[model samples]
Target: MRSPLRTLVPLALWLLCLPALAQDYVPSRDAWSHASPSEAGFDPARLAAAVDWARANGEQAPADLRDALMASFGPREPDYRILGPVGTRGPANGMILRGGRIVAEWGDTARPEMTFSVAKSTLSVVAGLAYDDGLLPEPDQRVSMQVSGPWFEGAHNGAITWTHLLHQTSDWSGALWDIHDWADRPDGDDPANRVLHAPGTHYKYNDVRVNLLALALLELQREPAPQVFKRRVMDPIGASSTWRWEGYENSWITLDGLRMQSVSGGGHFGGGMVINTRDLARLGLLMQRDGEWNGQRLLSSDWIARALVPSRVKSDYGYLWWLNTGRTAIPAAPERAFWAAGFGGNHVYIDREHDLVIVTRWTPDLAGVVTRVLEALEQP
Candidate 1:
């Protein structure tokens, strides 16, 4: 017969877990519940001030993104021009989620807007899905093993790996969609003859190389990445159909008798994700919860852990996701906090320690907005 102490011990443990279990929440497709600032452990006035401050500090870029792109890169890069589609944008907007419920919001949170480099984070998630399905056995696996193109050929590019691509250290040379790799934020005036570092030896932020990764993943999965992301991630998380993933007009390729367009990793050349703040918040919530939605496991926890590990060359970056490692990036935020950032001041911040997901669009100062939100939290 079991002793009375055994029964009491189990009951006490269950009681201890009750609070945590109650705090966990996942919004459904049709409805999203809301919690007042005070109810969500925030000072109501302070949270409101933060939202107001963010709205006033919208991006300084031109409303016409094509003009903005040209003004930003045309002067620096030789022959730099938009090769993909660009469009006008909406006003500043965003939402704040505490414990999976909205605590405060402002602007047109439902309006879809171009989220430039933030799409790289979405690409990272799609890669994580490929990893889960055994399509990619190891991050260190050489890209040449799976991809049958000249993209990974030659001694320098031949040595590149999936890890190198994800960390932005591949230093892959060449052009895709007629845009040369050296033309992207080139170092020296002579970009065409710029020095090439061995793969994995140096870190460089290059959109052309990122697009190569998208193409490689397309080859491995033999399907469009957006489809994989929708079926495995977005749909399970109850994301609406408003979000879109796009690539350059010339980025199309023929794979196994099917013509498929490879997606871009950012909007530097004018193609990436255009998504609403609410759906963007949902992605953040999924990352905050370790890729688990409700009771379903979407991405393996192992993949997320690997993705968050800081790269050797860049301590503040991890698998396309930006980090606040050592509190260097955002002093007010926790070191474990990570985010997906885009041009035109779009960002989705996931604060795991505080159970917070803050989405801000067209807000120039992300750190300032985040600091304001952190200050509003009521101390336990």
Candidate 2:
């Protein structure tokens, strides 16, 4: 039998959170409600200063993202070249949301730009949706059990579970889309000969491994991952139709006699999410509300909690999301805060304690941005 106290504890917390949830403003498709800085309990002058700082601190990458990609990663990885679509980036822009309404915005918030590794966080949501739909029952189950393929056939690879892949600790060695796992941020001079660690025992940020996750998800979903994402999450959240998720030229495969692209998890080889700041803010807001939107639960709260839990090997990382644990990643933010960060400085920060969602684009100083935003909040 379950303890009475255990049952009542959750009930009590839900009751306490009810009023706050009721007070939140949900935006419509046509327009987002706005609140002045003073109305949102922020210091107006300080908030203005934060926006100015963000505008002045845009990342130094060239506007031509193809050039930027070559300049940033070409020298580090062998045979580095883009195999997917690339686009010219826009200038710095972002928005600050408090209580689910816009409090401040700057620059071209409507421009859709490539969001690199931030797509990883969105991919995590896609995985969670699969888990909720009963397609994926256990996160700790071996990948080989769900789908039979050469990717997970080896001794080390076969041992990997969904949890390991989600945490970026699988260290699954292989090449997908002709890109070797060792070629991504490899060690020393010879990347191809890099040593491999046991599954779930090491943490390495590799796009090849991430793309493998996408492929695995594609196989399980039996349709394009982006289609699932659009139908399930984005549509329910009222996200604009402008956002697009792309995969590489070679990433397409026939599934169930249907040809569909397996979307890349980041823009390392070029394709990921191309979205505006507002749509990004909507994603952050969904996370801030624990996967609920306008009283409808698009994603399970349990999944959100699980996704935000720090991985054993990396405290600052949780299911592809970046955490502010130990105040290391964002010193000025609350400890419970977490975010989706991409290459080229895009971010979608979720601060539940403050009922805040902050989205930044092409801004390198994430820590400074958080500090300035927090400093602008009115003191009790």
Candidate 3:
């Protein structure tokens, strides 16, 4: 129902042998590459029909998405300094990529907007970068083992591992950026509920805890997470620079005598990822190529493999990313097909079987999107 353990796990053993060369791809279009639907063996009309379904019947999840936040955070959370209006969603937009080329698109694909939890996927990539640089000693190694200082102190928090944080199962109890782990989506009505569990024992989608993960990673890297991501992952992948990852004002900490911001895992507290669909599509394309953009290995297939595999607590969720499992999330998608989903219907679907990457924003028809895209690829 959500998204780790501690051991001095050996580092080298965790590194799986990946293909040395991941073919590099260049974008034909500045925004993205383009291809005819027929080039990908897809029916143009069927694809349009699917896009039409989304545009015609799509919905905004309503202000309750923010109403709950406002209620929980008091009009607006004070620490959420770099956020947007409560419950903001842009006009519907989407893009389809096949063979790393755009097959179709609609709406204002370039307008950046809040992407909610998809920031977790972005964070996942940063984690991948950390591993690639050998900063993370081991995936199963305790976060406490890597990060030092009062931030990750305490036996309960010390027991949590990187794998647990990635899977949203760490159950790390703490308040970061003024957002309490228990204040968000409590299993019951009590907002002040104090039933905290041990680390890695439960699965809960707590942004406060996720933010803790961001902070811990920040301390471990001793740099702003966004800059590291930009230099290591996004720039190499040629993603748009307009996209921004937000962090709370209070989340700022001076590291190595330099001030830095620790970005949150998602927009639950208002500060998260604000990115355009084209940028998101680029991200999907990178993932579709199995952590390769064209051919340069920006992300290791080893990390991607672990990131996509289902976690122990949630069958339909992988490490921060969502998986198509148990016929939930997207029954129309293949089991191997995974997606980076955000609140308000934002999705970056990775259909490796079809070499397809689809990104949709603020649409209610994920099933229609998947079904239509798959149907088009099947047509004569």
Off by over 4 Å in 1: 1-21
What is the C-alpha lDDT profile of model 3 across 1-380, one tens digit per residue?
A: 21112221321222121122112445733555567777656788888898887776655545345654555455433333334333466568899876667788999898888888899988988888788789986888998888887656788778889989998988776666666666566556564656767766678887877788788888777788889988877787777879898887677888889988889788776778988898898888888878776567888988899888888787887789888887676776777888888777788989866667899998856777888788876531
User: Pairing residues by index, what is the TM-score of model 2?
Assistant: 0.94
The lDDT per prediction is 0.90, 0.88, 0.76
Shift of residue 23 alpha carbon in model 1, Å: 3.0
Error of 2 at 203 (Å): 0.5
Model 1, span 1-380: residue lDDT tens: 97979956764564344343244689999898888888777899998999999988886458899999998999999888787778778788999988788888899888888899999999999999999999999999999998887899999999999999999999999988999999899887688998889888899999999999999999999999899989999999999899989998899989889899899999999979988999999999999999999988999999999999999999999999999989998999988899999988999999876778999999968999999999998842
Candidates' RMSD to native: 5.1, 3.4, 7.5
The model with the greatest lDDT is: 1
Q: How close is candidate 1 to the true structure, as a TM-score?
A: 0.94
Candidate 3 Cα RMSD after full superposition onto the native fold (Å): 7.5
